[model samples]
Target: MAIPTIRVGLTAATRTMAGTSAVPKYSDKENGIIATDRETGEKLYTVMIFLMEEDRAETLKVTVPANGLPNGLKPGMPVKTVDLVARPWANLFNGQISSGVAYRVSALELDSGE
Candidate 1:
């Protein structure tokens, strides 16, 4: 039986926009083409966010849907993550192992503290 990978939910006490929310995500670095979500066939966007926990805050480059972010979002605006999940992936490239955590967000909305 194949073991299904469990997706861990991610949250933060506070999140703020760090950059433009409409930035396109590129899959091919050389070609400079925008990436897309395979399952839903939607264009992908990369958003810069700062997640604050306790006394620390770290910036994260998160992948989100092109249309998932509501308009009027700008840097320093307080936001909340919707249905956030993180998955770890690793692969061998040219005899070297490369690994990273990929975060997916269903949507980003103004923080209502709900």
Candidate 2:
């Protein structure tokens, strides 16, 4: 039987580190998203990314479905990803500070031959 796959999108903005839970809870204002194949029904993967544009560092979180992911991706699987951070803020720190906004996309490879 062919594995199942699904696509999902999660926002990475407005992240607050909770004292508990290994993963940080992300809000919707960030508008982050993840996508996967629609044939395999597998678990989703979340990726946390940090970027520094000027001075302030921004935290971003993203998720991707791993239904047919290659080699059954684990928690520490190495995946290639890209980042887009928010622009610098004016009238603050002489343009040395920034809002710290960013987004990430994780493409999970599945094993299914679909």
Candidate 3:
């Protein structure tokens, strides 16, 4: 069972945008093993959410399944994004603001035959 853990504290982003080589907000090292209901033997892995300086309040969030999740995740639920980028807009007042929530995408991984 691959456990979802929280990564160590990282540096904050500056007012200016960073290059492509910028480090990630969270890493696999922060994940850990957790216990769920004892009698039912049901367990769920919990992963940490990261909010970096570059990640504006409006940035989109997405969650992707690893090698687990047999039934697959639900759409419009919530998940972290595989990658983050500022949406392009001409002016500051344009659709540049961000919400603090992340959206979900389904049928990404986990299937009998790809």
Candidate 4:
């Protein structure tokens, strides 16, 4: 059976650090997996975003292929998550099961002229 995923799009602030090394570092075998670009064979990184709605605030962490994110993206910069999807995952841990949403995006671009 295929896992169902939700497609979502919204304007949010990029909370991840911005620089030549904006991507977070992780061991190749950490979490029993390694993230890489399939077509370009490049490493991937996780980006954090903050969504502010009225008085409620939420945060999401998404993985982006190396150099996949748009340039000039910085902290507190308004941006849009292009082709964003949320996949639900469940795993057995110790003696219990846990589940959460994993986010991915094809690109992150500045939400200008909004």
Best by TM-score: 1
- How displaced is residue 29 in candidate 2, in Å? 22
* lDDT values for all models: 0.75, 0.37, 0.31, 0.69
Q: What is the lDDT of residue 68 in candidate 1?
A: 83
Regions of model 3 farther than 4 Å from truth: 1-31, 34-59, 67-99, 109-114
Candidate 1 per-residue lDDT, tens place, 1-114, comes to 442244644454455554655588888968998899987888899888888777888777778897788788787777877776776788998999998888778788877556
Query: Ten-residue segment with the worst summed lDDT in candidate 3?
Result: 14-23
What count of clashes does model 4 give? 0
lDDT of 3 by residue, 1-114 (tens): 432333323243412111121112233435744443333444433223334356553323333233223243343223323222222223345668644433222213222221
Error of 4 at 113 (Å): 3.3
Q: Each candidate's TM vs. the true structure?
A: 0.80, 0.29, 0.19, 0.70
Clashing pairs in 1: none
- Candidate 1 ranges beyond 4 A from true positions: 1-12, 112-114
RMSD after Cα superposition, model 3: 17.0
lDDT (C-alpha) at residue 61 in model 1: 79
What lDDT is reached at residue 18 by model 2?
A: 15
- Expressed as tens digits, the lDDT of each residue in 32-95 for candidate 2 is 5333334464345555544334446545454444421335444433333332222222345865
lDDT of each residue in 12-104, candidate 4, tens digit only: 542233223246535466574556766677677787887666666677788777666777667776666678799999999898999899887
As for TM-score, the candidate ahead, 3 or 4, is 4
